[model samples]
Target: MNIAVVTDSTASLPHELRTEHGIVVVPLHLVVDGQEQVEGDDVGTDWVVDALRRKVDISTSRPAPVSFLRAYEQAAKGGADAIISVHLSAAMSGTADSARSAALESPVPVHVVDSRTIGMAVGFAAVSASRDAAAGRDVDDVLERLERRLDASSVRLLVHSLERLRRGGRIGGAAALLGSALAVKPVLHVQDGQVEPLERVRTASKAIARLQALTVENHDNLPEWAGGVDIAVQHVDAGERAQGLARTLADALSTKVETTRLSATVASHVGLGTIGVAMVPRIAD
Candidate 1:
């Protein structure tokens, strides 16, 4: 059976990977100072960082159902027997809902999976699905592999401030931390598809250190089925710091680490100087 894999820009999958795997990407929308632009296309992390630095109004919107319908139609036209659409967390964005709406009108069987996470965690899931589909695995097998990757993944972020997240309404339980004393750095994580506060520190240095320690701890605690772990360091306007963090992680974990810029949609919420790490277990082939 020929299956097609689809994902959103917020997945943070590199262009090469997406192209190599034939994964179709649906971009979300970024509203910049009242002007709307497509994420990853018309706007990217550089634009978002500049806008944030200038205090420009920035917000994100999910793609319309028609956008996803078009993607499904094109895939179907390319002779796909089925499609698996993986997307970012529903708690953070309505992209999944739009995909579902399009699936109802699709010509082929479209299975929309809410990754319940963002960044490389979702990217890894899409890659896994694409690989399984290319291997001629059944739809169920492909979905199973995708779910396994999601279940074995953990993401942590260190942001200079929580104001951006609060302003975007993406802060879940982390809202309480905003009331604390000033100059407090926050470390957040994705839990139950919502961004929640994990730790609060007085300095960015301390927060970065804590972020690394927590990642190491999480890596050590993974289940045996994980086989191995893949780590990706993500940042918004903090490339140097992200590279440093990735190098430290690579040395400590004895594995290669990939550093990628967060998509504009996510950066709009996280704001500048945001650094994150996403770790997913590599399931045995």
Candidate 2:
């Protein structure tokens, strides 16, 4: 059976990779300085950063269910027997809810999956699902593979400012340090599908070091080091730092690392100078 893979733009997947895997991405909507812009179409990481620098007010909204319905319709028309719609964590946004709502009306079966993480973490799951789908796996097998990767993945984000998060009401467990000084960086992670406090550091350098240490620990503790794992370094307007971290982790783990810039939908909440690493441990059969 032909199973089509779909994910939101928040996955931060590169255009070429999505095209290569036959994955369709539905973009989130963003309003910057009272001008509405679609996530991938106009509002991206650079645009969000620039708007923030100009003291512009930025807000985000989840895509409507119709957008997803249209995508499902198009997929069905393209000879897809089914669709697997992957999305950002429900705890963080309502994008998954919209996709699930659309799935109910799809002509073919549509399975909505919550990646339970954002950025490259979602990208990893979507890519896994797409690759297996391309390999002629049935819808059930493709979903199973995606689930295994989601369960094994871990993400850590280092944010320079938590103000945007607090304003967006997505601070979750990190709310404990809301009153902390602006210079006191916070290290957050996805736990139980919600953004939780991992720890707090005084400086960006220390936070980066902590992220590296976590990457190393996960790499060493994998069931089998040779089984292979995927590492992704994602950032919001922190390209240089993300590249350096990707290089270091790649060398230490002796594997390649994928680096991507966060999309506007994600950057709007995380603010600028945010960098993180997502590690998906290799799951054994």
Residue 153, candidate 2: C-alpha displacement in angstroms: 0.7
TM-score of each: 0.97, 0.96
Per-residue alpha-carbon lDDT of model 2 for 121-238, expressed as tens digits? 8887888888788778888888877887888789899998888888888888988878783758899998878888898899899999999998899888775523678889999889
Poorly placed runs, candidate 1 (over 4 Å): none
List the lowest-lDDT window of 10 residues for candidate 1. 176-185
Residue pairs with clashing backbones, model 1:
none
Q: Give lDDT: candidate 2, residue 170.
A: 82
How well does candidate 1 match the true structure in TM-score terms? 0.97
Error of 1 at 208 (Å): 1.2
Give the candidate number with the greatest lDDT.
1
Error of 1 at 264 (Å): 0.3
lDDT of 2 at 198: 91
